[model samples]
Target: MTVRSIVKFPNPLLRAVAQPVELFDDDLQALASDLIDTMRAAPGIGITAPHIGILKRLVVIQLPSAAKPAIYVNPSVVQASTEMIRHEEGSVSMPGVTDDIERHARIRVRYQDLDGNERFEDAEGLLAVCHQHEIDQLDGLFWTHRLTRLKRDRLIKRYGKLIRAS
Candidate 1:
């Protein structure tokens, strides 16, 4: 397992939909581990395979309070609560910026474990937002797309400033 470089914002792959993970084998496991390592190195609580330029539907989340990371393969939102919550969201690929984006307060996701066993999870609060954010990435929707045009443009300008300053 290795910590791969994040693909970065503006990478076309971030706008490309990821393919479902059909092979539940060692290679997939290794990729999972690598994702975990890369996420930890990025210091992000969640990351998707797409973040590292792998167009596979895989997500790794390690909530700060959780005992360990959770891996989901081909995760999709099955149901979402009517209640909405705006939470600060960011991405490892985008790196330096975040904005409050409204999302369902709760959600039920259907996905598979590394072994390909289908499972469902009911998540709320931060976990719910994280799932939606990552799943959107899988669907070729970058987090910024959730923002209003003005907000997204401002955010991108700020990002460019940060990049130039660095």
Candidate 2:
């Protein structure tokens, strides 16, 4: 597995809705592995294919305490609790920025395993937050979109300053 370059915000591909994965093959597995590697390198708990410029509906996630990363192919939220929770959210693509974003407290997700077997799982707390964030990426919505207009603008301005400084 190799660490892939993460595409930053304002990249056209990050805004493009990702296409579903069609073939579950070695290539797909390799991409998943690369995503895992890249996410780990970014020190992020989650990442999506589009974050690396691949417009495929794939996500890799691993909580801080997880033993290994979990790969989700064509993942979508099947159900979400009405109760909402606010969590500080950030993205591997748009590094060095975070803000409180409201999300479902719990969610049931339907996705395929690496072998293409369909699976369903209910997630809560931080796991739920991560899934929602990655699913948003697949849907062509950056996490920053969850923020208020004022917050989004401020975050973007801060990010621009960081970029210029670097």
Best by TM-score: 1
lDDT of 2 by residue, 73-142 (tens): 9999999999999999998888898999999999999999988999998999999999999999999999
Output the number of the lDDT-best candidate: 1
Clashes of each: 0, 0
- Candidate 2: worst-modelled 10 consecutive residues by lDDT: 7-16
- What are the TM-scores, per candidate, against the unseen true structure? 0.99, 0.98
Error of 2 at 136 (Å): 0.6
CA lDDT for candidate 2: 0.94
Clashing residue pairs, backbone N/CA/C < 3 A, model 1: none
The deviation in Å at residue 118 for candidate 2 is 0.8
